[model samples]
Target: MRTKIILTATVLIGGAAFAIAQTSHTGHSDGMDHSAHQQEQAMTGAALSEPGQGAFAALSELVRVLEADPNTDWAQVDLAGLRAHLVDMDRLVMDAVVIETDLPDGISAIATGDADTIATLRRMVPAHAAQLARDDRWTVDATETNDGIELRVTSEIPAVVARIKGLGFFGLMASQDHHREHHFMMAQGKDAHGH
Candidate 1:
């Protein structure tokens, strides 16, 4: 009987404490609302505070167009800068293969060939392939005119196959994530020391 009475008192005290805590925190449980914060950010021009301001600006414009007109044809929109960047990226990958011969190679080549060039080629080709895959400018389509040699995005725009079609090279030979990381870091604002 004594133990039961003591246990009932403890439960009553604990329940009262929990009720007080709930009443005290009733109006403040949700904390800061992020959607409202984002709205304020948009109002005060904090939306474009990132280092890639131009890219963000372009994205904002695209968003605005889509929001204003649901039927907006984004492909027909004037994305000159975006298009130029895409084209430049594609051309860079295609050109990366040209400088491949300067790399080093081991005893894998034929009787007469520069080993360094072979090595460089082996490294660069994979990098080129990865870049080509990521480049959104050139779309990969099936109805290409040249079988396995050329890739067609549309009826008008055509580019060469990315996988070294004649040489049978299909995948990246070295790490390509580093290249992506480097590009992303470069896109960000420079440090105080211009790094």
Candidate 2:
């Protein structure tokens, strides 16, 4: 009786696995075998069968190469398909975060020192911010500062808002000096006289 029960359990589990393997999934773009046999092989440590596998393989190779010798110059490293998932918009925001995050600690914000950088950044992030605003992701708030225009994103994320209010992303561009006295610029650099 115990032997029969064990055989029955094994057969039932195998049947369920077979049923799941036949169904198609829509969201994932990678074309690969989703069969139970393939899953079992993966569980057993075989090579992964998916589109981004090559990307992962490349990353692994990069790590190995770097590990073998730590002095690998960054510019020489090949990053093919390394950023396949990042959209242009996300890339721009990421760039802003990267730059702005480098500002001095405890600073609520940092303004761009050059007109070119400010204009370009504004063109990139504000549009995304505007869309987010419409969706109530942020409230459109623009204030004139001593150096240049200051765009603020007022959102409902209290935690993020608190951090931004405390140690946030703010800055002024050196080009628009006229707006200076009209607003209290946060950082270094004196009034319009290129000071």
**Top candidate (TM-score):** 2
Candidate 1 lands at a TM-score of: 0.20
Worst 10 residues of 1 by lDDT: 102-111
Which lDDT tens digits does candidate 2 get at residues 56-148? 544555456555776655554434323221222233333443223321222223344455445545543344334334534335444444444
Give the per-residue lDDT digits (tens) of candidate 1, residues 98-190: 212111211111111234333333433333544545645433321111111222221122223322322222223222344433333233322
Error of 2 at 171 (Å): 14
lDDT of 2: 0.42
Give the alpha-carbon lDDT of every model. 0.39, 0.42
- Candidate 2 lDDT score at position 188: 16
